[model samples]
Target: MSIPILSILVFLPLAGCLLLLPAWNCRRLARPIALVVALTELTLALWLYASWKGLAVNPFPQGFLLLEDAPWIPAFGIRYTLALDGISLLMIMLTAIVFCVGLAVSWDSIKERTSLFLSMMLVMEAGIMGVFLALDLALFYLFWEMMLIPMFFLIGIWGHGRRLYSTLKFFLFTMSGSLLMLLAIIALHLLYAQQTGVSSFQLQELLKVQLPLETQLWLYAAFFLAFAIKFPLFPLHTWLPDAHTDAPTAGSVILAGLLLKTGSYALIRFGYPLFPQAAQMMTPLFYSLALIGIFYASLVAFAQQDMKRLIAYSSIGHMGYVAIGIAAWQPVALSGAIIQMANHGVTTAALFCMVGMLDERAHTREIAAFGGLWGKLPLWSFFFLLFAVTAMGVPGLNNFVGEFLILAGTIKSSPLVAVLAFCGIVFPLIYMVRLVQEVVFQKERQPLSLNDLNPREIGILAILALLDIWMGIHPAPLLEMLHVPVQLLTGGTP
Candidate 1:
């Protein structure tokens, strides 16, 4: 009852959305409304972070912050519950940033149904924040489904060419997976009740259920299916490139920056810990899938004509590193995976954003459209160059640290995987450098009066850039935060 700050973080956006309801003579107020809502969200998020810094021990592993719980569906033992941990803390932070930046970035791009647009963005942000913090299976599932709706609408309504096809494909694929997860969640709940006599959806309760190996295997597989689809791992990944390519700039940012992490989060928070034996048993298969995704996606990326599609494919490949890192299960490997998840969100999202600028200015995403843009947009070129370096894990940027940690951690677990994954690093450099050369130095015609990043865009990119450097140089804090969680999950002590 202490103000439930986390609830404020989750639901304020829904409240902010009502401010857009009158929708009449409010056109002038649309941007201001959205900005105020996002800033308010940001303030709360920062407050939680600053508060977290002052706390002596993480209250998350016991359960999340500002805890709240109540019965929602007593017949099914499902309760409405939500909380936060360090893992979800990072996710919440990313969601807040994406929403704020997405809102700001839309100051010029979105025109029709301005209020509706901002409203959807806020709802999506709130929904995703809910997903990260939800501690009840039912609550988590609700938030998970909530995320898909706004994204579907955003794509269907505001996206570029052939948005309908892409949106429908995304919806169908994700919906199917969600249904499977629902069934699995129900099974997990039943198992909990049968074993414990008291039915509850509290994650802490479920985490304690000593499930039989067979049930655990089946449950893990079901949950893994749901997660793999979201991670878009290998054969299950067809929906991603299309989605990223067709989605609007803000859409791509959320898709790459935040949505993908949910899968990995579920894996760490639920899948791996609850079904450690199953994960260890099937590690080989998952690692192989990860390796295939890495090479296959990268190979396909080099062949892409559309820059957005290229970045989309690139996401699959980078996430492949994450999957591989997680599968290794060594402390270093797991830590690397987590670090890489954050790094990828920051750098890849920035890349997609810059590419969005290119698409907006040139009206083309084709790699061949531009040449000699370096002379025209020095500032844009510099930012692009910096992010491109980040993408490839250049030594100075944050990406390098994450990749190095992952590679080193994974190698300690399995040398073969480390060797194979090492081969894929060269490809990032090749594609990123080539894309930069073509976009900046090779293009002949100048961007027709295209200016560089304005103050807002620069602000967003600069924060990311600073983090990219700071994390790379001094990852000590993050490493410390990760050590205990990673050790606990992996059956060891920090």
Candidate 2:
């Protein structure tokens, strides 16, 4: 029998993480090893993507690659089921890309305890992979928590001032919500046991779970609380700005790039199917929050001088489209959401990387200090402009396609939302254009004689730029990969 590719993907990182134990004395080798591991994972993910032509279609089963499953803890009826349908596959690809970017961004910059820092990043990749592939809810939660530990240490150990406070805040906030989800999961397990007299954690089995309306509503609320807090929708978003501001460059990159997306991913993957009826009932509430987040976060982003905080706020705004797409329930819309999530992962990671480069050189994130950079650091300005434009949902880029699908989908749901969300797009144009004007286009105001992108920086940004442009002109493959899972969720004719 062939070895399970998905299992290999998950364990390879843990293998890399474990290697740190014996070689703790040599800190210099750790970053290189981690970079190698990240590259290896990317190769594997690209292999998978190529197998599927990196395309997703409606009715997503055909797009899934390297699916594997088996029995584990059979007495309690649990299984180690894993699959890579469109959604999972995209996330896996995104994980690999961002992991590579994070490693490259941190190269030659992170000094203290370099070995331990890379170890945490390895663990983080492992955890995120598990979250994307695990088919069993019990297994999913384990992956979910697995991601938290490495992140805590990353923020707490390598983070800036108030690192401890920021890490704790991030931990407590997520924990508070996830705890409620745990209760809900237990409730689901017991209910399933009561209904079928089998204590199973199989996803296919649980899909058949029929519960009272009131019960579904309550359970949905519990799960939503967990996903929402992480999504940091509207009111619950307070933790994100602080966490991003204080976290090290790599921490901010991974946090913005992968950690927060898990919340939105859970909503699309589990929240809806687990409670479709409840989802239908709560559409209005979800839409309202999405709109508020889109407009409000943009305003907050506009007012920020701290580059990381501005990007962090923009993350919340971009995610508003994810929520909007989910609520829209149109096939076009769902595809948009998935694409946007991937686009956000790439573009935002690139932007945060720029922030890292800036902070590393200038010793501060204040935008005013950056002027007349176009000549002094033309390459850096070019890449930053590219990423900033993509983030603003510019035409002929990845974000534009997703944003269009979202608006087109939202119109079908609520024309008011379609109109309101467009307004949100304008907000980004204001700040993003201004970012270009002041930071790059303005006359040379400072003679600090900044440098352009180094080889590593250009390499990562090149990958991102290629993807952004690729998605803009040729998004068909992506749309194909995502079709089936979405159709499955909607129960609509494909």
Question: Highest lDDT among the candidates is held by which one?
Answer: 2
Worst 10 residues of 2 by lDDT: 54-63
After superposition, candidate 2 runs with Cα above 4 Å error = 53-66, 444-446
lDDT of 1 by residue, 35-121 (tens): 898898888877776676544254545534457777889987888887765566767877787777677666788888888888888
Q: Model 2, 1-494: lDDT tens per residue?
A: 16688898888999997877766767677777888899999999888778774333322353345568788888878788777887888899999999999998898888888888888899889999999998889888889999989999998888897888999999999999889998998888889999999998877778789988899999999999899988879888889999999999989889988988899899888888888889889989999999999899999998988888899999999999888998887788888988998988888888999989988888888778878887788888888888998998888999999999989988986899889888889988988888778888887666675567888888888988899899888999888878777776677654
Q: Each candidate's TM vs. the true structure?
A: 0.95, 0.96
- Cα deviation of 1, candidate 1, in Å: 8.7
Q: What are the per-model C-alpha RMSD values against the true structure?
A: 1.9, 2.1
Candidate-wise lDDT, in order: 0.84, 0.86
lDDT of 1 at 108: 81
Where in model 1 is the C-alpha error above 4 Å? 23-25, 58-66, 443-449
